[model samples]
Target chain A: MNGRCVITVGDLGEFGIVARIAGRLPQGRTVLLGPGDDAALVDAPDGRVVVTTDLLLENRHFRLDWSSAYDIGRKAAAQNLADVVAMGAVPTGVVVGLGLPATTAAGWLDDLADGFRDECDLVGASVVGGDTTRCDLVVIGVTALGDLGGRAPVTRSGARPGDVVAVAGRLGHAAAGLALLQAGRAGGAGPGDPAPAELETLVDAHRRPRPPYPCGVQAAELGATAMLDVSDGLLQDLGHIAEAGGVGVALDLSAFTVPEELETAARLLGADPLDWVLTGGEDHALAATFPGGVRLPPAWTEIGRVTEGEGVEAGDRTSEHRGWDHFRT
Target chain B: MNGRCVITVGDLGEFGIVARIAGRLPQGRTVLLGPGDDAALVDAPDGRVVVTTDLLLENRHFRLDWSSAYDIGRKAAAQNLADVVAMGAVPTGVVVGLGLPATTAAGWLDDLADGFRDECDLVGASVVGGDTTRCDLVVIGVTALGDLGGRAPVTRSGARPGDVVAVAGRLGHAAAGLALLQAGRAGGAGPGDPAPAELETLVDAHRRPRPPYPCGVQAAELGATAMLDVSDGLLQDLGHIAEAGGVGVALDLSAFTVPEELETAARLLGADPLDWVLTGGEDHALAATFPGGVRLPPAWTEIGRVTEGEGVEAGDRTSEHRGWDHFRT
Candidate 1:
């Protein structure tokens, strides 16, 4: 017989588990109705709502051994919330659909809910409602909603020639962290040999991405043209802006200030740091374009210039990598 | 070599598949910005929006051999849409996150999209945006958004002791259909012997639930005190209202008009017809409580009454079954 008195989800039943999760979450001001209802009611003050959805499956999107349940929860919420902000809207609430194996521990789910609540709190949003079901593996589906605040949506097609391209959050940090973790898993390091503080920071970045939530609204208020979350690599995501707007984006690679940790990790791993910055995905940075002559705020860094052509180029070389494609890549 | 060339999602790629699906879906009036952007912008004419989510796994929630992809898509959208209407709101749009195996045929996805579109078209809603990813099994997450149209939401906690309970739409049909399918799978029936029309109707009900979409609004407009969609068994869902309102629900077994198909199926299988009507789930029938003096419309059938105590009772006996629990049952 097992000595530990661990409770599984099957033991608690659906309603019991839902009650535990709901009891812990604090409702936001915009939530008219929270959990324990047929549906949640969220305030859409501006008469329009921006919506986005994402799916993360176990092993494909994340591994349980590599990231904790809390980490997965944060990452899942972060990615969808980033999408809402990318539309130049203020996020109001999120509804999640979680499918987990019946054998999953009850504590693991509680930690997951805590991660969702904490991450939502960072942006003044809340977990308004969700549905949980039994499945063979852990699959998370998050849909985030936001209010546009009476402003015209900044879409990808609005970018044009003579615009300046910029970004508002970290790049390559998650990728470098991922590399470190992969190497560590390959017998490079164990619990006995702790990673350096800087390297550990990278690993943490991969585990839970902290997107610049307010920067999206700020960019729109500043009259930014096209915008999107840099979920794909820098060059490939820029290519979307170019393709949508019928223009070209030329990047100046020298403008990027590679963090010391990325450089050091790259040196040790025999990899190109520039590649991580240019082609890595999952950082969820805000990439946008503005009129060429506009004085940009400090939060955004100019990375490239829009040109009268097609596709994306970086420092006289055309990029071939198009970032992550779930099926093909 | 294979006899026929089949285009899988892996061969078509993510962008290609998205473009194909997007090309097929026509934008609704409420969609300010449709797919191909970071997020979709939906017009919420009222100040509040109703949202709900549900997850459907391949084997657990449905079996591919028993139901078509189109049937699964309709069922997924219907369940969430029903939740919205249960709150007295009209569904505006839906965002889906789908995880499919790399080997899934492109045509199957197209049919699924068609089903979603057709179902949305029924209620003047549309598929605004979605995310697709690769997984070992097919998992679908659907989040539906609705506009309350300035009406106060009808919650489950509003039932009073003197209130009368009523139901709208089909009940026990889906459950009866499921039992038939399970029997057929266990070698009871084959293609050589076609099922009667009534049995086929039950099977179809299980595959695609026909939730009375407009009845929810009708009930609210007619002054429903408490309401919920019966996705779980009638007794189980009524128990939720009873518990929430701090009152007991006493259902009359004689009040129900069991469909002939249910009776025929029950007779053939040696099962109780009353059990199907009382405990069957997934029909998405709307159950509501109203003032005892009020006359319910023709769409609603009075079935029970609110009492001073807690829990649900049918005729003289209290219910023992608690319907479908994702983790436990």
Candidate 2:
């Protein structure tokens, strides 16, 4: 950290970071060319398209001390790709915009960019266009574009009563991870690491989210009635689907199971894994509703059912589930 | 300047922002109704597209004291759209990623949204999509999509000897405005209403760029040998066209004229107006070469002609000029 650098972006340099970051991209067979070109071109199928954008700022969304630049990049790309998939579309290309202070090291930017490329690789997408400039802090604005491949998009408003509400990804992990990190930072849990023996994986989950991309596309392919990315947490996100689809949902938490790693971590923080599962965010999981026994994708699991109500119910208690609010003080 | 915090986003938040922004958009006449949905659909002719992005950070690119959120929004959209026009394409739609402190007023965000809408309105393009998240400082990322509409892109690599070099708009005022603001902040500029007499106009140019959108599209339609936006400066940007086109240009600036506001500001600063004309940037004016009478648009005025030379020449003098390099020491 103390290697070199007079502050100011002039000191940190521009093209140098681009060069380092460009080296890490997979240039997946689909990528015609990565960076360095004035523009990047990706394969767009001969049909309609889907495009979405999301912006992430360091310190606001994540801390450098808590997450590597790579994790941040990957998480950013994952969230955007999840949106396209939620629309029943296959992501084809991405354009990233990065803003950083001149005091930032060349390596840090490179690592952050590498994170983006690796995440794009995970989602089977390619980097197309990007622009970088100096800023007071690190900011990433990613735009994900996709091709529909002639399939009609399944929007959030398509769910109907009697539809089975299902989720196809992990829950409670990121929240548990965040709780552990915060606990550790605050000297709440014993010591050593912030998370008790059980929860470090949860902390990892918070830093590096894993969205179920394939499950989303498959759900769409299999005629998902309504689909949404569980970025704001399960109960909260499901509430969105309920409202959008104009239906109510009751989640069977007793039927909901958590990975042992996440459960262990929740226990260390003296918290409920159920609460984490119900309210943790940044997981980028997909939650959808179907009419019947729709052929489930391997990565997805059944969780509950959509009914004729207004809110979400977990077992005995009904949860209002407000969703993640970024601007809350 | 203090106002009411009438809205709590958590109660109505991200979804609220989307609904409000999308509601004010011009979605009927020229734009289709895919705005608030998952993605937007723009009518792209020729089945080809040109795209570009740029990121602007507060403090690095602008000061809150000098610019309103609306101005920043317009500037961001203008810059990206200029790149599309540079490729001889018509802007179809725009997407934005905004990052700012959560505590900031929602109305300011609305003003920023207004700015984006106003700029896009100029080109009959709609604000198709965008994303917002919290950040320590304001960061704006804009991506502009355009349609070639059946014609090939007039690139920087098409100029040739004997091509008449012509410019479609004014050169450099934003840089001068920046200098005025810096001078005012340091108490270097004379005390008056705005420090510099033409400061208002210069500041206006910096805040909301007036790119010659129609002229560029028309120039391409008229078969421009090569085309580009004067983003860096007249001389520096033209140098790109020269180097890429494999032909040199002789800019007869002995017969040069500039906007009166720039002249007034230059005189007040005791600086040469020609310097601004030659190497100042951020005006986003169009520059192109022609093979014949160059079916010029009504707004275009021919300033110079391309010649078989080594570098650009202002009158008889060689322009070995370097424009303002933001990353330079």
Give the distance in Å from residue B297's predicted Cα in candidate 2 to where it truly belongs.
3.2
Candidate 2 lDDT tens digits, B28-143: 34344256545555544444446667787778777888888889878888888888887777787788887766556667777888888898888877788887676767778888
Report the lDDT of model 2 for residue A188. 36
For model 2, report DockQ: 0.43
What does DockQ come to for candidate 1?
A: 0.90
Clashing pairs in 1: none
Candidate 1 — which residues are off by over 4 angstroms?
A1-3, A185-195, B1-3, B185-188, B191-194
Question: Each model's fnat?
Answer: 0.94, 0.41
Candidate 2, which segments miss by more than 4 Å at Cα?
A1-12, A15-43, A185-201, A320-323, B1-13, B28-46, B160-162, B183-200, B243-249, B290-293, B303-320
